[model samples]
Target: MKSGVHRKLLNYFLGEDKTMKKFTLSLAFLLLCLSYLPLWAGDYRAAYEKNDFKTAFALAKPLADKGDPEAQHMLSGLYKVGWGVIKDYQLARKWMTKAASQGHKEAQSSLG
Candidate 1:
């Protein structure tokens, strides 16, 4: 009888531990998906169209850094015109070159 009781208790605890592990894994997966939501949802063009250069810069910078040609072009324009950031022709040229190299037609034309 004592052995049976001990075995039941051990099984209950083991089940609880398994449940906790599943819950922990689910929570981690949720957080991971949420963290990437901004990158997936950022609308830099809408921000720029609204004359919100600061927001546009914030949205575009990460994508530009990740080698997105359109984002690089937008960042280059912002740097060239001193819109959201200080006007830095050097940085503008750097980003424009990156975009042009990626075959961004507007950036290529502007560079030419």
Candidate 2:
């Protein structure tokens, strides 16, 4: 089968030995995820600014679980403030450390 320019471009960029369909799917998924990040963070920020801890927690938890530093920092703050979840210094410290390890400045300051 002839690979299209999209496949060629994906191969060039990714440098991986993936099938055409696999490469296309992976690229699409990556693009979708990247596009959603700003909206997802905006939603989280709106929830946080409104003091809707439950909503903020709901929005941040998945991204945090996925190792997003900002989400981890938000999760840490939520734990620290007993918002949407019980205040747990240990959990806060744990998440803060994770974010700090990812070079999040606020997390670094919090850890310090």
Please provide the root mean square deviation of candidate 2 (C-alpha atoms, Å). 8.1
Best by TM-score: 2
lDDT of 2 by residue, 1-112 (tens): 3678777777667856457667778999999999987886668878999999999999999889999999999999999989999999999999999999999999998778
Taking every candidate in turn, the Cα RMSD to the unseen true structure, in Å, is: 5.6, 8.1
> What C-alpha lDDT does candidate 1 achieve relative to the native structure?
0.92
Candidate 1, residue 29: the lDDT equals: 100
The C-alpha lDDT values of all candidates are 0.92, 0.88
Clashing pairs in 2: none
What TM-score does candidate 2 reach? 0.67
